[model samples]
Target: MNKPSSCVRRALSLRPCAFAVLSLAAACAAHAEQPMQPLLLAQNARMPSLQDMVVTATRTEQPLSDLVADISIVDRETIEHSGATGVADLLARLPGVEITRNGGIGNATSMYLRGAETRFTAVYIDGVRVDSQSTGGAQWEQIPLAQIERIEVLRGPAAAVYGSDAIGGVIQLFTRKGEGAAAPYVGVGLGSQGTRKLEAGISGAIGADKALDYSLGLAHARSDGFDTKTSGAHNPDRDGYRSTSGNARLGYQINARHKLDATLLASRMNSGYDAFTYKPASPVDDRNLHRLHTAGLTWAAQWTEAYSTRVSVTDSASCYETTPSLYRTETSLRGYVWQNEYRLGAHRFSAALERREDRLDNPALTASGLAINQGRSQDALALGYGYSAGGHTVQVNLRHDDDSEFGGKGTGSVAYGYAIAPAWRVTASLGTAFRAPTLYQRFSEYGLPTLRPESGRNAELGLRYAEGRSTFSAVVYRNRVSNLIVFSAPGGCPSTFGCYASTARAQYEGLTLAASQQWAGVQWHGSIDIQNPRDLDTGKQLRRRAKHHATFGADTQVAGWTLGAEVQASGRRFENETNTQVLGGYTLVNLYASTRLARDYTLLARIDNLGDKAYELARTYATPGRTFYVGLKWAPQ
Candidate 1:
């Protein structure tokens, strides 16, 4: 009899998982068997900063619970406990956020916020906007999770504050920073799908006065994934991927009123896959190379106790190369902004001016070996005001954008909130937003130069309650989108090449509810989302969007160990607007545990897809099956 296959051997290798579980349980029992001193000691110690400040909701730092907009915050503690390696995993858990991908990791990804298209959603890192000019989507896979300290999401129109690409709302990422002293850490792990990963980082304050600070992170991962296509006629070879990313930041506090900072982030990826082509095409290997980089600089000063100003600059680029086919593309963006704010009595006012340019290089293989490039630029101005007095707050903003190719457009928003009681509040908001046509959508082959900007309106009413260790929030919104771009071969256009047109409309209405509580020694959090997205032309549901979804998770510490479980479920989605192809709904359950090994070291393990259930996040794509990962981490004290 031959030896068991490699996959079989790995499956049987879960003996370590069993061992870890037993060890964790034994350690917990031993601690539980003792007095509850540790728990009491932890509770007595001043809690880790419960008052979290966020700026994404309104471009100003304010208490998370006090913001009038619908917002979600993914703190560092939550990110660490979720046992997620990919940013997509973390995003899928948020309320009203949806994702779709071509395959597994390293593949093209898409995100929909409040049922809006990916391009309409804006992404920012350290106040710098980043996106591919051609596709208008952020390179989510290239962002290393280990380098991020937190993420904030706003789920409504934000064009009045940030200009274009804010029709769906905004997401901001903050990088890690050095604390009091130097701290360094490292980690390594292995799991299913032949996956391997390594990460290391260090952060510290420098100089006698500790006025200078620096932080850096490095990460690399590789995985041999299963066939991308689960059904239909396609290649069966295993697809594999490799990725490396790095992020670094430097800061200097010149004085009590002046400060300067710089940040850089870069990433590279190589992926292999099988292509399904009927006509004559390259029979050789199919692969792609992807690279993304961003850099930013800022100088801020406080002229007086109530007046301040800032100036910033940012640059970002995204590049892609395809093998065999010899296709390559590069998109770059440069931005500059000047902002000022003044505080008077019980009101604050702000003004900003911004200029941004986009460039793309996609040369055609002409007879003469020549290349052609395309570019566009835009200028925008914004004004905002806020007032807070006696448990009541109100905010409003207005902006105007002028593009070189599309002329000019204006947008505005207003929000009001009142506290019913010390622990309860009610809020209402109305906003307008727009998405400009991408270069590919307006000037490429079969593109329409006469296309107009897609515009929309958002109206929301919300209720929130917070008391002791329990908190809950609910929001209901209605959105109307007009001048949607679509492709059709009208009259003079040839059937081989359809032309783009803008006359369509859409409506999206949704409700989101979320809650969290901590009692005794256990903590739990959950969210539910119900939405209806429809195309006004055909009165049909949007393709690849579920009408309902929910998530629940809980964790507790027993003795010297902590254990947790999570569940995520989504309703069925149609592959086409006509609703012929039905992609079934799915539910996934996961388990994770952690325990301290020594003074400065710890052990972590997780079992994903605990029951080995099969599911689909996208049509014809194969999602991960039963898998697990075990790792050890160490940090300097």
Candidate 2:
């Protein structure tokens, strides 16, 4: 089938949403005889206990259950079985997190972690910070899923360990690397909204003794997407998008005591968008191009039986290329960190120092109320301690950061854990965090140059039970933020275009529940979240944050087939701070299937919005409707 070039824009009312659901049903009926594959099972060997190794919560590997923070792991097996098109879709299923996108497929995207501001959360790729400096957030739409091996998410304040922008949490993406033997894979897919994708990759060891290993992947995707806005518009045109990305890695083990590694990733995208208010004479539709690149190098050495050291350097660059008269911007980050670890019996101690520079050039965007040639630098020192003994765990962290733009700030955290039984555990923690003001937030015409960093204090309590085939977890947390930066309305500002100022206090209290169970061949995974995020002064709910969020799903593997179904729901939320505009609550259903076609080959199909529900995470943002997709993958047995 050929790709679509355009779409006719029409109002996405409830009636159309209902009809779209019928269309999805018809498509599924056509494939009723095909049996899907089962859900992905654990691919790694189990440890003696549930609290296994994790790298994000602490710089060192430690048991997740033993750590004071909440963490979730998206393993390779889960990724393959989910059959997700991108990271946003996969992350939305996690507890205490919400994803909001302006449009479907390669559009501006943001994540709200525990109802915190978007800039409070940080994202890393293979330990290198990869977010855009211009926006102070990751370009989630531009991140390629083909190269990702797994994702590790640490919830709650981690500023003491990761520095700025960890007030909400930290997300780290691990790339695929060669392990044992040489292997190659390829895949192709076509889906609704005129989507098509092609991907290929290879990984293996080279030379004698398998001392050198390398992995490389390439991908290209394009979509003739639906209209981004349909409620009321002057120009009704398809907002198409195209992108290409690459990932490459190399590692060399010189000896048992020394090793070196390097990795690089690049992505480029061209996407079309429309103006806030459509107009024919002014040209409401236009396409913009973007480019992102990141590279890293590291060396590790085992100095002694109980000590190890590692040093790394990472650099990343991003560019937004648009009409010179419209807007154009570029950003770069260069960073270096040195870490040392020593272990004494069941106790571990670690220390690290980091330096990073952020630079931005917005020559063409200077007229858009933001300044040009902005730069900032930061230096941090972190120390950590961990001890484990007889069903008891203790962890503590302390860090201080000095910034050229904001002077200095200090943060720290402590947590304790106790195991009543081999499968049951209880934990509690208290932490402090801060978010440095972004360059744009300070240099823009709407900026407050004298702004101070936002600060946070949080307390968390959690319980977990993990047995043979099932696991359950529940947590309650409260985070208080002070010195919130917000735009002052014209009424309180010196001019009509109001300036930004730190004026409000905010608090977020929430409860989260998550569980996974497998009986026979059937597997179930689900989560529920309840939160009350309010502006303390006005006592009103925060914008774009739902008070209630929940997800339920089940998948099974039978024979060579796998089948899965999912449902997601969100409560009503306000569109702005004043709470006048309301976006109603909504629910969505999705279905997926995969089956082995032959040796080393498989077929996959999925339907999103099985009910063709009409809903919005943000007002006026058109989301994907009843959608269909099919693909074929090939790999060695």
Give the top-scoring candidate (lDDT): 2
lDDT of 1 by residue, 440-463 (tens): 666656566688999999999997
Scored against the true structure, residue 513 in model 2 reaches a CA lDDT of 69
Best by TM-score: 2
lDDT of 1: 0.74
lDDT of 2 by residue, 82-152 (tens): 65667877878777888888776667778888988777888888878866666777778768776788788
Off by over 4 Å in 1: 1-50, 278-284, 365-372, 490-495
Worst 10 residues of 2 by lDDT: 7-16
- Mind sharing the TM-score for model 2? 0.90
